[model samples]
Target: MKKRPVKAAMIGLGWWGRKMVAVAKGAADDLEVVSAVEPYGDTAAAFCKENDIRFFSDYSAALADLEVEAVILATPHDLHEEQIDLAVKAGKHIFCEKPLALTREGAVRAVKACESHGLVLGMGHERRFEPPVAQMLAAAADGSLGRILQIEANFSHDKFLSLDPSNWRLNASHAPAAGMTATGIHLTDLAVKLLGPARDVRVVCENLASSFPQGDTLSAHVRFKDGGTAYVSATLVTPFVSRFAVFGTKGWIDIRDKAHVESPDGWVVTKTSTGMPIEVSHVPPAEPVRDNLVAFARAVRGETEYPIKGSEMVENIALLEAIIASAQNGQVVTVA
Candidate 1:
């Protein structure tokens, strides 16, 4: 093939952002974090020094770099729309983390901006690159799973308990519907990937244990545009649990594992059809986040199309907003 290493900017040097930078460091052949932006200068400077990348307190400074052709945004939820718009205007390919935008309009606007600029926009739905998620997608595509019927997932972890008031994730406006935006959105993305866009959403969520303003638990029911339905839940203050089950007319495939990129010994999958559920261990043949980074590089190089297109991104964001609205209003919200 071709060697097309993208000079990229890593924005938002928080927990997840730092992890992404590490992935970039690991995949040094495919992509490079040539620049980084984080409001807290000390930590960002230290990190950039460690990684040997440029550091900036403001994102616009990174955009000025002619060599940085792409950017991976791990910024706060509310900041995505404006930052994406700016990046697209800067003529840079973009990869943004999950819950692309908190509002439907904002998400649509971001997608459209990328389209108008003719830029590759990749959503960091990293789990989509995961082995389990990839297997589920294969089932949906290859007829291994018959006509899709439903998807059930419960992805939760105990990380939010560590969040202090100063963190953006603690604010309801930043992470509405409790774990919905922070964690459950992965299942939602899997729903879209396996069953297509969601048509309706009903959610119930709460912060059960914390004295802080955090959303701890959430359960959402989604109706897909293509007749399949899904139930996905997430909790904040609990042992890590990541299970995604996709049911078809013939059989159901289930993957059980800990949260992303964590080495929990390994992952397991169970497929049930005739009688006993067949279990198998899965050690990802390739590192998922690294693969995603390489894929983004390919997209930037015009070697292939971006798998998650702008339209699907817009639809997923619509569903995300619907889920949040449903939880807050205590009713089913039809996805627009």
Candidate 2:
């Protein structure tokens, strides 16, 4: 028997939200975006009309709709906690975007709300679903990368350079530590997964050209509780550069992405060992964004558990808070 697709309402109509809706169209068997909520309704209403989905100018209206089995929040950074609470109260599952909350306390509260409601809370860390990244994660988990010592990652792009100066993404209050919330958070998530919980973080932020008050370039150094370390960097002025590498006692692995996640070309996975010959493998472009949504849908349908744990969700935001604090104080900050 074919199961019905999970009915969903996309709560934001920004660049990424529209992109997600476009991708979800290809996964009709697993999910369906039945409605959208955009306070600035003119442009978004047109988009919703073009996609043949209902539109609402108010979030409460969408929450009141009985057809919405789940709510996909691609809203602003600061609005996530309150929005998640509303969704849980409405008895809807949630698939929230990355940096779930700006503060550790907010992340904890959001996670707890969903857990108490017996609702599935899906996160938006799609990089984990990328084939090459999955391989790298497996290598780190298995004995291939013996005693993971350090992990380094760089996820930078100039995609936001063209945004208006008044855009929330460019605003310091919404997106602190330059590209940390936009891109560096993903790197930190991967690092945490590979190296366990982070103990502390130190960050350096600088504004070379961009209008962002915090900076255009951000570099973060993190030490994990288990003795591993990570160096992560995110730049708003650079061309798309997505790379992740893990170093350990036995070997090292590197994954080089050819293009951005939205429109991927491919990836190159390189492995090097002390004595063994270096090996390189090519991975074709995949729809990890779509994969993440489908996985969330399956979890909503009681098929399987979501890949992101509640604990990790809280930890990532905690690390993000630490990064921002370190950037402000010019000193190491503990990840609480």
Candidate 3:
């Protein structure tokens, strides 16, 4: 059976949103970007002309169009919940990027709105679609990890030290908990996806040497609902590192990627059995952002269901908020 492509209206023409569109072009066969909402009138007009997708200054104009059946949001972190509510109300299926909302209550409200309209709500947690990550998650879930004991992960980079103060990445409210929002938040979602919902979080965010208030380092310790523990760290001024590992009584699996974004190849995974190290192997590279978009298109077309449910989304946001609260209050915060 052939799958029909989804007709989507993309909201936002920023770098990330534009990259999403660029990756989908000639790559995702099941996605058709029919419209775009960009506040910058002239730039949006030029982009729409080149891409051949309709451009509108107001998102509501795109929503009003009958040709747009879905909405793809890459807007600011704060507008997610409100925009999702409006999109669902307009009867459009939605695909929003990670850190879905700035807070848990907002996430819950957005999820409820989607449920009320019976719209498919998709998220762009691109790492979930990475082959190595999928393999590690499968191993953890399929008993290969044997009562998973601990998970350790880190995503560190030095981009923040050179960032301008006005950049959204350096905004205080947008990313108050240092690299928690920019980098470490994905690890939190991955932990919850593989382990379970977070019960409590202990975080310490510090600005080691930078003068910026956004901070430079974030270290979080999370306890899962199942009593499993995880340590996740993210830093702004550091060598590029992407390391994730999960250990259990039986054995452990480790993943190492040389770069933060797309690398020349996929991640290298090392495993152990009987307390002896196994040879590391390369996992086939995948375009995760493209895969994530294709997955959303598939779900909207009814070819498959979206993997991240509304409930899971709420939990992820709650965990993020708890981490921020812990770091600010200087105490462990329980995730509600």
Candidate 4:
């Protein structure tokens, strides 16, 4: 017997939400975009009409549609928690964009809501699905990286620099710690995945070029309870700079991105060992965003567990909160 694709509603029609719809269009065998919810009714209605999907201006109206098995949230950061609560009450599986919640408590509540309901809680961390990153995580998990000592990463770009001054992304309240919410949070999620939960953090945020209230450049130092350390940074006013490196006693692995996750150019990876020749390889461009969506759909179908664990989701938010606190206070803050 053939299984049907998961019928889902995308609850935001922003750029990224539209991208998800396009990706899901390509993966029709596994996931189906049945509808969408957006406050911008006319634009969203036209988009949905062109795509042959239903559109609703009210979120609760979409949730009441029994055919929507899941909801994908690509909305603003501040609305994630409240929206997740609504989806939970409606008995829908959830796939939320990154920095799931601005605060640890909110993240904990979101995770618990889904867990208690036995609903799949998918997160938008497509980086882990990237070929080179998956390879790096495999090496770390299998002890090929030996005793991990440190990881250094920087994910930066100038994409948001030209946004209208009033855009939520440029506002301090929605996107704290400069590019942390925009880009650095992904770095922290990967860091915590490899190094375990963060123990403490120190940070510096500065507005060097752009007029963004939360600043344009961010640098963070994190110490993991298990002894690994990480230097993470992001800049909102730079050419695309995506790089991740892990150093261990036995060997080291470095990955550099030729394009951002949204564009999917490709990746160059270099592996070095104590007495072996350096190995370098190029990973072809991949649709990691689609890959993540399919993975979430599979989890919703009970075919497999989602890769990003619930604990990691909460821990990433905790690390994010600590980073923001440290940046604001100019002092180290413990990750709660």
Q: lDDT scores for all predictions?
A: 0.82, 0.91, 0.84, 0.92
Better of 2 and 4 by lDDT: 4
lDDT string for model 4 (70-151, tens) is: 9999998999999999999999999999889999999999999999999999999999999999988998999988999999
Query: Model 4: runs farther than 4 Å from truth?
Result: none
Clashes of each: 0, 0, 0, 0
Model 1 per-residue lDDT tens digits across residues 12-95? 999888888887877777788898999874677998899889988988999998999998999889888888888988899999
The Cα error of candidate 3 at residue 320, in Å, is 0.5
Give the Cα error of residue 26 in candidate 3, in Å. Answer: 4.2
Candidate number with greatest lDDT: 4
Better of 3 and 4 by TM-score: 4
The residue-by-residue lDDT of candidate 3 on 240-315, one tens digit each, is 8888898888888888885655442578889886567686888766688888888878877777888777888888
Q: Choose 1 or 3, whichever is better by lDDT.
A: 3
